[model samples]
Target: MFQLDPELESFRNDARKVAERAFAAKAAYWDEEEIYPMENLKLMAELGYLGITIPEEYGGSGAPVVQGTIMLEEIARVCFNTALIAQGAINGPSRAITVLGSEEQKKRWLPGCVRGENIFGIGISEPGAGSAMTDMITSATPDGKYVVLNGQKCFCTGGHVATHIMVFARWGKTQGPRGIGSIVVEKGTPGFEIGHPGPKMGGRGVAEVELFFDHCRVPVENLIMAGDPDSTRSFKRLMSSFGPERVGNAAMCLGVAQGAYELARSYSLERKQFGKPICEFQGIQWKIADMATQIHAARLMIYRAATNLVDGFPDPLEAAYAKLYANEMVQRVTNEALQIHGHYGFTREFPLERMVRDSRGFSLGGGTTEILRNTIAAMVYGRAFDQRAGS
Candidate 1:
């Protein structure tokens, strides 16, 4: 059995209690009305969840990524949309700045983020480049004391409401991943415009948006890892942060699955069919058993990946495995849980339908399952290994 340290366990318990009291009541309403849970975000900030993994010196708790993972899981159990908001608000931009930002940049940004006064968005995944990040056409041109940005970023989670964005763009004339580096663009900067939030099948409240940068200029100091614009070293450093990002993604999936399982189990015990509770039936019992087993397995995978984070970055292979398995596992578990609810599960009256819709996106986000499979295989058989027959 996987176990959390006492501190982490306490954090988990507090997160669960907070979610039940604060997030649960508003979850269905937010999903149904498609409104962002602003009040719940304030509650999270008040509880110190907004700064869970930030350093204490930066007005944060200085907790490890594991604590963040535990809290994310618990909060996600009650409201996946709120959890999504939390991930982007708390982890996405904060992790990038923590790892890549200079001391001055950190001093300027980290404190507000920890205090929930600043929310940030991640800008990558252009329309032309989703999985193939190296193909991005977004260009950052070097000029005296500034870099001019021109391109568009699509599917940027939380972009509509972000105070700033961490943008990944090609620097100068360099090509491919070698040319890619990140820079911070403050909201309302000249020539930087955020589009209307795009609707989604799940994660309703958090707005995914498109960012357009035409001759957008930011101070040279905004460049993360300021050095040669074409340096692959800087790009690789940014990519390293993806490990923790994937781990957190896995934790969200686990939470969703666990929540669905609990609902199904409790409903089974109370719901009757043919003059007896469904829990007494062998078929229902077996389904619940399988759901529990898978949820446990996913949890173990998530924790194993989270604990293995080295200097706040997870081992790429382990993170990939955890994300791949956990994402697919949640889809299956949610489906089974919905099955347990019968026809009622399909109705909005029950939360199962919402869970099912939310779970569907896990496999696609934070690196698609197919992309993760390739990453895992590359790690196992060397990056140059080919699976073709008779090679």
Candidate 2:
């Protein structure tokens, strides 16, 4: 229903051009090496694309969340890893710092993130608990002047290279989301061990790893959103950040699908079959039409989700709606694009194969399709469904 303003479109164009030049050539190298793309991250910083949502007073662009999605979509179209570098600042823990951190903390952290001089990892999902976040068992017990943390965290994306990690653990033995609060664990903190990066089929360059907090003691001041003694109210407040994260995830998927479709569109025109360009084939034409229509729909859904925010972040329902569609849509779109290229698409030379691999992870991360369905249902019905209790 709505369209991008000229300024936003200009911003999108600038990012797309930069990505085409700087990230396109290196996307394969980064995916093959599985090494962090710090150089590209620096370029993003120079462009002021990092921390697109953080306020300018904190040395950020202070742009709306929509701009962040646009930036991510453009970069992911060329290189998924480079787009992730931008996401490291605008999503997850860095974002929480902007929203929930004290003035002193914001002054200390947000600028570095905006500058791309800092990468913050999120330590939330655990081996034993992911979708059922309330079942998390990590503990953070109060000591005299510090809180001792004891737990294991898995799926800590960027943990291997992050300067700091924001970990959520139980403040006491209280279970089921209560007493769940988070604290910042600086790199090299005693008793905090970072494991080797876990290999993935996609999102290759960014490191996702395991984290251990064995009696990891940190100053009580490191605790954020921990004001309530019982910590009863912080869980919902903290998790609201995932709304924007999901929107960002959807944007990346949208970009990848568009990239694949464009490649297919070009190939169909030049690729001949039976002495005629494949573009003349009705079958190929229909596939191209479907991909274009789907991409257009996803773009609109993502922009809508990005623009209409509840309290400066995406509404969970809207984010879920956009993410679910984009996640499923990308898989279909990429496959169709690959099919259009025929046998050549299955090879690495065309980038279609890589696009298919990279596109798969978006649905897995951010939130699973199953989990997102639950989220959408909760929002629509205005009820929190406890699956543990059978109806």
Candidate 3:
């Protein structure tokens, strides 16, 4: 079921070793404590995984997207939570900075990120805006050497633990989409504080929190991608970087689905029914067939997206389609796998219950399945689909 191009086979082998050794060591602890896997993060850094997408000149591997996706997929099979942690820890704001940071900003941050010494989070969603990026209310006012940030951000994953945040906000007091700009804000700035963490249904190990910026002062030099939201180039950068993020979410979903399937398969083989193993029964065989089919298709979609990315093809619609399909496919696979286990799946004895909860987050995170469908439709029809048209 695993396919690696000859060019990427060695890298995949290396990544699998790391996932098996380093991630396996920390998975159970992270799950039990519902805490970030700092040990795994350190191990990834030591192995140069934290810099998967960063440039070679920036003390990074500068690996291709295929290599990166392979690493993610393998890690997902072992520990999806750590896989997600690695994905976002490495990509999220690091991508924004690598693409748009000023020379000085790049020099200041990229090295640390590459070294796994610095963690960054994206601050795009707000209390007033989730899917609607245009309605962000955070304001950044020029104050001589610094920009004074005043607003709040919600549903911010890694916001509490990150050393820095790439915050999108309106420059000055203007309203609507035109005022949007992205600036990097360091944690522990005088007026910056993370609020209580949100209670997520799953992926509990990845902390999501609200950020409060009360007259927070970030140096103007930290402004990475500045300009109105209407700027096509700026919007394009957001779109390009977003494709990887969506694919990473899909990878996590695929991992959880695979984990659930394995759980069900193991249980079916072990739990006897009447005269023999449940797995030998036709009804159980059908469930396995469907789960395997869906998972196989989802895996192909992920690989397709990764291949397109490696080829430098900007296939946003294809990326969306892959993410949407994989997200839904995994949910179905996991649910059915859970059902195959029957009553045991409903309890905490098996990981299927956790897998169910985790799979739910995939549809909601990155971009909601509904929102992604609209995006895909917009791309195909060459017209924006107003999700709020009826609302």
Candidate 4:
């Protein structure tokens, strides 16, 4: 069995209490009305939950990455949408800055983020670029002391409400991943336009939008990589952040699955069919057993990946495996849990329907399951193998 240290276990307990009290109460209203849970977010920040992994020098708790993952898992168990916001609030632009930003940049952003005074977003996927990020057409042209940005980025989580966004763009004439770099774009920069929130099947409160940068000029200091934008070294530095991102995403999936399992387990015991409770039936009991087992397995994988991050940058292959497995595992667990609830599960009266919708998106976000498989295959085979070809 996997275990957390006493300190971490205590922290997890505290997080679970706060999540149930603050996040769970507002989950349904936010999902029904598509309202952001600002109050819950503020409460989390005040309790120091929002900055679990940030260094104390930057007005944060300086906790390990595992603590942050534990907090996310607990929060997500109650409200996945709120958890989505927390994920971006803690691990999105703030993390990008920590990994790639200058000392001055960190000083300016990290403090406010920890205080919940600033909201940051990440802009990576474009209409033309989704899985193949290197195919992005967004370009940053050098013009004296500033760089002019011209392109559009879609599916920008938190874009509509973000105070600032870290945008990935092509820095020079070079093509593919080598030419890509990240830059910070403040909310009101000239010629930068953020569109209205796009529709989503789940994660309603967080606004995913399109960003238009037509001759958007930003100071040269905004450049994340100061040296050799076109070099492989710079690209690798930015990609290094993906390990944590994947781990965080996996934790969210694990939480949703766990919450659904608990609901199903309780309903099975109390909901009697014929004479005794349905849980006494062999079929219902078997489903509950499978759900509990799978959730335990997924949690172990998520924690292993999160702990690996504490020592150094997590291994990309390990992160991918955890995320890929947990993401898919949530879908299976949620579905079985819903099945246990019968028709009641499909109604808004219970959270199972919402859990199902929310869990479905996990396999598509962070990194698509298909894309993650290719990553894992490359690592295992020592070369990219074409899946379409007959072995």
- Give the whole-model CA lDDT for all candidates, comma-separated: 0.85, 0.88, 0.78, 0.85
Query: What TM-score does prediction 4 earn?
Result: 0.96
* lDDT of predicted model 4: 0.85
Worst 10 residues of 2 by lDDT: 223-232
Cα error, candidate 3, residue 61 (Å): 0.6
Assess the local accuracy of residue 225 in candidate 2 as a C-alpha lDDT between 0 and 100.
Answer: 65
Which candidate wins on lDDT?
A: 2
TM-score of each: 0.96, 0.97, 0.92, 0.96
lDDT tens readout by residue for model 1, 1-391: 5677787788788789988988888888888888888787777788788888888888888888878888889988999988987787556878878877789988999988876778888898999888878788898888999989999999988788889998989876666668788889999899899999888998888868999999999998888854245467877788887887788889889889989999999999999999999999999999998889888888888888888876668888889999999999999999999999999999988899999999888888778998899889888988645433386
lDDT of 2 by residue, 1-391 (tens): 5878999999999989999999999899999999899899888788888867889999988898898999999998988888777777787777888878889889988899888877899888898888887788888888988989999999888889998999888876587878888899999989999999988998899979999999999888787766233756888788787888899899999999999999999999999989999999999999999999999999999999998888767887889999999999999999999999989999888888888999998888878999999988988899988878575
Instruction: Specify the highest-TM-score model's number.
Output: 2
Question: 3 or 4, which is superior by lDDT?
Answer: 4
Cα misplacement distance, residue 277 of candidate 4 (Å):
0.9
- The per-prediction tally of clashing pairs is 0, 0, 0, 0
Per-residue lDDT of model 4, residues 1-391, tens digit only: 6778899999888889988987898788888898878887788788887787888999988887788889899999999988888898767777777766789989988999998888888888999789878788899898999989999999988788888888888877776667778888898999899999978888888768999999999998888863245476766677777788888899999999999999999999899889999999999988888888887887888888887753345778888999999988999989999999999998999999989988988888778999999999999989966544365
